[model samples]
Target: MNILLTGASGFVGRELVRELQQRADISLALALRSPGRSSGPTTFVVGELAVDTDWLAALARQQAVIHAAARAHIMKDEVADPLAEYRRVNVEGTLNLARQAAAAGVKRFIFISSIKVNGEATVNGKAFGADDKPAPEDAYGLSKLEAERGLIQLAAETGMEVVIIRPPLVYGPGVKGNFASMIKLVEKGLPLPLGAIHNQRSLVGIDNLVDLIICCIDHPAAANQVFLAGDGEDLSTTELLRGVGKAMGKPARLIPVPAGLLQLGATLLGKKAMAQRLLGSLQVDISKTCQLLDWKPPYTVEEGLRRCFGRSN
Candidate 1:
């Protein structure tokens, strides 16, 4: 199988490149925004993704495409029109690539979406399923939802198989942003006032997500299907901190603070969204993925954390 992978330098794309290269039956090509020295596979400089970006040279002879690039969600966006900016890349650019790939005889296109398309949080222990009605709460989520709809429509019109994988809080080695901050605070032995928060959240390990992406590459059951990706284990904020502590061989110093008081403080500080992420529940149901594709998350949460910290279990 010949494949073209976009965002080859990104966190998820980088891992996908490494895993796909190890397969003897696959020939991989990377579509990068800038020119870079190749590690092994052929690389194509496609420049910035947009509706008008030409992909003819890159899509030549490519059988499948794994698109993982996007503007990404910014917590503190300074752009005047954030939604338009997000749509420019996530929706328009994605549809543009799909259309071009279809014209180039690409058989399959796998899109890496976000769980935010389902909503910001889940209530009453209900997990977000792939078939759920989309309720995007933010600009980034809305853009992804639009992109998914566009891809499905394109697939119907062009006969190209489209697979959408929505993953929540993917974490692994070299992770950045909030996950990295938590690790740093724990490493410094800083006392965190999050011991009392009781909220369930699902996280996907990078290894597990990459494995699922590989499965969707050729699985007949994956054609035109939306799948949710996770580690199949839900963890509370306190439990997650403890797990991270266990993995790092350093017990977390947590202070038992009331969840209500924390929320109040966050509201006062105008950090309600951040607080919800730490205090609210967001779970994904990946049972459909397993049943349809006979797939399982190969790495357990504990094993994944150990790997994240460079420790062997």
Candidate 2:
């Protein structure tokens, strides 16, 4: 199979490139945004992702496309028109590529979406399912939802198989942003006040997400289906901190603070959004993915944390 992967230098895309290269039956090509991003005969620089970006050379003889590029969600976006900016890259650029890929005879197009498309948080332990009605709250989530709708409609019209995978917080060795910040704080032995918070959140390891992407590449059951990706284990904030400490061989120093008081303080400090992420529940149901594809996450949350900290045990 000849596969073309976009966003080859990104966090998940880098891992995908490494895994795909190890497969003997796959010939991989990277559709990078600029030259010299990667050094290989198969690397094609297609410039910025937009409606008019040229992808003719990269799409030639490519059987499938794994598109992972987008203007990611920003917590404090300074742009005047954040929604328009997000749509420029996430919706318009994505649909443009899908239309061209369908015309180029690509059989399958796998899109990496986010769990935010379902909503910000699930209430009362009800996990977000794959078939739930979309309720995107932010500009980024709305853009992704638009892109998904366009892809599904294009698949119906063009006969190209489209698979959408929505993954929640992906954490691995090269993880950045909030996950990386948490690891750093834990490494420094800072006492955190999240011990009393019992919010359950779902997380997917990079390996697990990449495995699902590979499964969707050729699985007949995956055609035009939306799959939620996760590690199949949900963790509370306190449990997650302890798990990280255990993986790093350090005991977490946690102070048992009332969740209500914490939320009050966050609201006073104008950090309510950040507090919600730490004190709220956002879980995903991956049972459909397992039943349809007969796939289980190869790594458990504990094993994934161990790998993240470079521990073999």
All-Cα superposition RMSD per candidate: 0.7, 0.9
TM-score of each: 0.99, 0.99
Q: Please, what are the lDDT tens digits per residue for candidate 2 over residues 32-103?
A: 887875455399889999999988999999999999998998989999999999999999999999999999
Clash list (residue pairs), candidate 2? none
CA lDDT of 28 in candidate 2? 94
* lDDT, residue 84, candidate 2: 99
In candidate 2, how many Å is residue 31 off? 0.5
RMSD of 2: 0.9
Give the alpha carbon lDDT tens digit for every residue of 1-313 in model 1: 9999998888999899899999999999999899885579999898888999999999999999999999988989999999999999999999999999999999999999999999999999999999999999999999999999999999999999999999999999999989999999999999999999789999999999999999999999999999999999999999999999999999999999999999999999999998998999999999999999999999999999999999986
- Give the whole-model CA lDDT for all candidates, comma-separated: 0.96, 0.94
Give me the candidate number with maximum lDDT. 1
lDDT of 1: 0.96
